[model samples]
Target: MKKEKTIETINPTTGKSLHHYSYMSDEAVKKAISKCHKAFETWKEISPKDRAKIILSIGKELIKSKEELAQLMTDEMGKTLEQSRQEVDLCVAICNYTAKIGPKELKTEDREMVNDNKGRITYAPIGVVYGIQPWNYPSYQVVRYSIASLMAGNGVLLKHASNVTGSGKLLEQIYQKTDIPDGLFTVLVINHDQSDTVITNKLVRGVTLTGSPDAGKNIGQKASAALKKSVLELGSNDAYLVFEDADINLAVKACVKGRIYNNGETCIAAKRFIVVEKVYDEFRDKFVEAMSNVKTGNPNIKSTQLGPIAREDLRNELHQQVVESVKKGAKIACGGKIPNGNGFFYPATVLENVKPGQPAYEDELFGPVASLIKAKNNKDAMRIANDSRFGLGGGIFSKNEEAAFEIAEKYFDTGMVFINSFGLADPAMPFGGVKESGYGREHGGFGLKEFVNIKSVMYR
Candidate 1:
């Protein structure tokens, strides 16, 4: 008999183990894929209206267990209880939005054809969809892909980050409570090798992932080699531009939240700050002061504004980035050192005089560290914002809303843009990125179509 491998889920708040899950064996993984393929056969036969009904019921189940799910997320990951609750709320909202619009989005349409022929276009379900999600916003990331695939009449297979295995299982339990068919959604506790096997399986017709760009590339290549469709939501060092006419106070507040939200582990979190020369000094001072004052402690506490990094290695990696950036001429404005504590704690940090050659300027510093760059003017600031290989999401703070909108629409080379605020994903809006941030989109009405086949039938 082969020895079973186990994954220990550790709580970042206390650096303690919360749970242990035995990894699924290769045989079990293959069985799960077979089960998902079986479920998809039935799921695809269901009407879109019926699928929407089940999806809406899943939303209600999520709301019923919001508090418990939120606690699980906080215990497994380092997000605050408030933020975890918000993540569950967002998942519920995604379910609700997809339920409302999915039927219409999947309905067959009659189209005009040439030569006196009538044509009908139909959205048909593909086979099973495989998703590889990360630990940050555990619930949201899983739901962001699963719900849309479900509504589109496809089965879902989730390979959640090992750190959040319990959260992933809880999500599966919640789905089971709904009227969803058995095996419709399965969470496989498997390793990277198993994931590669699943991706290459003929049963999995499509793939979607939310993770680093490097991971995206590997998965994209695997899916491409298999002749499968994929949608990737990858990483970015998102920048926020502070124009000369921008409101400094609002910008400071938004940037603070943007930089540290989710312990600064979010793909779209603001990492780079480009402030015009007219407001650089004042903006830098206030931003550094606010970031320095942020309280990092137990995520469960209501007063805690920041929390520890999700793991010790992640904390160490962030510090290395700060140290290397400083060695390359970036100056530490505040909070550069690691705090003495039991957990993986790094104080909220800000780096000034950031230049192109520094890691703080060139790479995604996946932690609560902000890189401040000065621009000569609005145009220069915009140039600096678009200088990165990543184009996931960005912001522009300007007094004139019209001007900001124009720039966001015409020039901001990002998937999503915030005019005067630092916001996270919205269910009503298309979310994804261009360039190295990965291709394809999720949310709004676009995601339901990502895994569906748009077929056309013509008849005289």
Candidate 2:
């Protein structure tokens, strides 16, 4: 297997060089998987309590090393240092959440199997599990799969995003430094060829991917060809709906967090804001002012709220998307064009008069760009929000709590929704999408199940 000395990792914030990592080869990937399989043998023999102890130990180590991990992520992918730190924190919380609680959560029902038998459902390992994670939320995506896979007695093979090779390496460092068993978790430095081999390996019983729909389809199909269970979390065009009765200030703030958090690179970020026509002007004014106030620059500093697009092409692509949207008649309120500077920075842009026919109406914009749509009323807002094929998450702001829940029920494909607030993430909640946003969840109990098998045992 061939490997490189290093892949160029540029800081999107200032276009500075942040050197780290060479890609691993197909042979390396295979070897790593073999190691994972070997570890799984011994790891599976350990009690869930013991595994929990190891996991909790890893969490404690994470807390101690949080700053270094966060700084490494910032250097790797150029998100704000604070954001990178937060991503590390999210990983720590996940490790803590899954470790302290997973052993009990995996417990089965103690019931008789009817007149002559005892029955119980057991959560068991499914061999080595392969996780193909993306660049956005690097640590979060890694934890989303790794924590559960480790907790459920399975080994893990990680093939993280290419742009985030440093992050992948950093993860390897963190897990390796902790008490967590060595081969139970391995981050493959290998490229897709190795990733492909790992996916098809007999040792890998299951695979989960957090990427694009096309990538998900290809990986999913390959996994199916190998007869492996797979979970796909593609992308989304999540909507943020605001009603006439909603709190403008709060809704506007949440909307900013939803869209601008992670520099608007989240799959669950609010892509479209469907607002009631009665308050469209107010919402637009406030949203534009807020977006304009957002500062996009150095990721290592404390005051920077938004950073660069993770990569240069991504920034160019986002600029093109906005330019194309404007050509299709979507008005740019505050930050329409790229800032007159170098590096991959696109000022937060707002799209007004975004309609069904507009290009921005259809796809996910992976930067600090958001589209605003006007609706006649609650029903109209619902109609607009539900108009897209992707339904990963959503938000609705209404004074009426019952009305918010009622409206929430009306959203057929939404996995998570925020009422009178913004859509954010929680380790306790199940997160995923429907339609093009992809199927399956990546957090909480459901997330744990994605990498395991449910075995029903019975005895007379």
Candidate 3:
């Protein structure tokens, strides 16, 4: 008999194994998929109001278990306890927003037809939706996709990252406590080969993933081969533009927070800083100083502003990127070297004089590393910001809100943009990206329709 494979969950702050989980066998995975499909059949028949009630209960449950959930997230992924708590709050807000608005979003619409006939459009539930999520913001990542899918009356199947496996199971437990139907939400503990098999399963009607562009391409191909709908939220090196009229102090503070949030592992985190020459020196100096002073330590401590990277391998990869960028042309302004410590800790790093050939300028450095670039003017700042191949999210800082809005609306190529501030995802706004940042929008009301079938009916 073949030996069963197991995943070990390690504490990023302590570099010790906290738990281990056995991978579900191929037979079990198939059975789980079958069960999800069966549940979807029943879930689809339920009224939207009934679905909303269950979803609201889930929101309440999340609030009730916020402390425990936040601790688990911090223990498994090394996000600051404060940030983890905010993540849980964000998840609850998502659940609340989806529950309140989902029924209306999915309600049937009526229209008059040209041939003296009545036409109606209905949002119909698809079968099981398979999601492959990342470790950063473990709770929020799963909640972002799952709640919206569930509110639309579809079953959800999660293949969370190996490192945060415990958080995944905890989420499943929370859902089970709610009034949601059994098998409607399932977490599969499986390897890559088994994941491919799950995607190829006939019952999985739609697939969504949050990861790198390379992974997106591979998953897109697999889903295409199976004729399944896919939504990809890929990685990005998002840029933040600072205009000449920007408030240097506020810009520096926002940029620092943006760079270091979630240990700087966020996909939408501000990675590039393109500042106009008029205020470049002041902004760069202050930004580097602020980033340099950020406190890095155990995530459980409230005083610790920055936490360790989620994994040792990830820390090494980020260091390699910084080193290679320096070799090309970039100059380390502050905090480039990995700290001498037990945990996977790297100090907040800022790379200045960053040029096109450097990894800091060309690639996504998924850590607490900031790349600072100087431009001649506002036009040049926008140009530098739009030069990247990825455009998940970006930000602009200027005193004139009108001017910033104009540039963001007419020129910024990213999916979402912040004026005078930096933020993560919002439940009311449609979030996703254009170009290589992947396709489809989540949150707002758009997510409820991503996996639903738009059926048309006509009566004469």
Cα TM-score per model: 0.98, 0.96, 0.99
Error of 2 at 129 (Å): 0.5
Report the Cα lDDT for candidate 3. 0.94
lDDT-best of 1 and 2: 1
> Tens digit of lDDT per residue, candidate 3, span 1-460?
6655899999999999999899998899999999988988998899998999999999999999899999999999999999999999999999989989988999999999999899999999888999999999799999999998998889999999999999999999999999887899999999888999999998999999999999999999999999999999999999999999999999999999999999999999999999999999999889988998999999898899999999999999999999999898889999999888688999999999999988899899999999999999999999989998998999999999998999999999999999999989999999999889999999989989999999999998
Q: Candidate 1 on 1-460: residue-level lDDT in tens?
A: 5655899999988898998899998999999999989998998999999999999999999999999999999888889999999999999999999999999999999998987899999999998999999998889999999999999999999999999999999999999999888899999999898899999998999999899989999999999999999999999999999999999999999999999999999999999999999999999999999998999999999998888898888888999999999999999999999888688888899999999999999999999999999999999998999999999999999999999999999999999999999989999999999999999989989999999999999998
**Model 2, span 1-460: residue lDDT tens:** 6655556777777787877677766577677889989989988878888888888877877788888878877776778898888887788888888877788878776777667678888888878988999998878898888888888889988888877877777777878886666788898877676678887788999989998888989999999999999888888888888989998998999999889888899988888998999999999999999999998888887999998888988888888888888888889888877776767888888989887767689888988899999999988888888888787888888888897897787754588887777656788888888887788887677777777778888887
With a 3 Å backbone cut-off (N, CA, C), the pairs that clash in candidate 1 are none
lDDT of all the models against the reference?
Answer: 0.94, 0.83, 0.94
- What's the CA RMSD for each of the models? 1.4, 1.9, 1.2
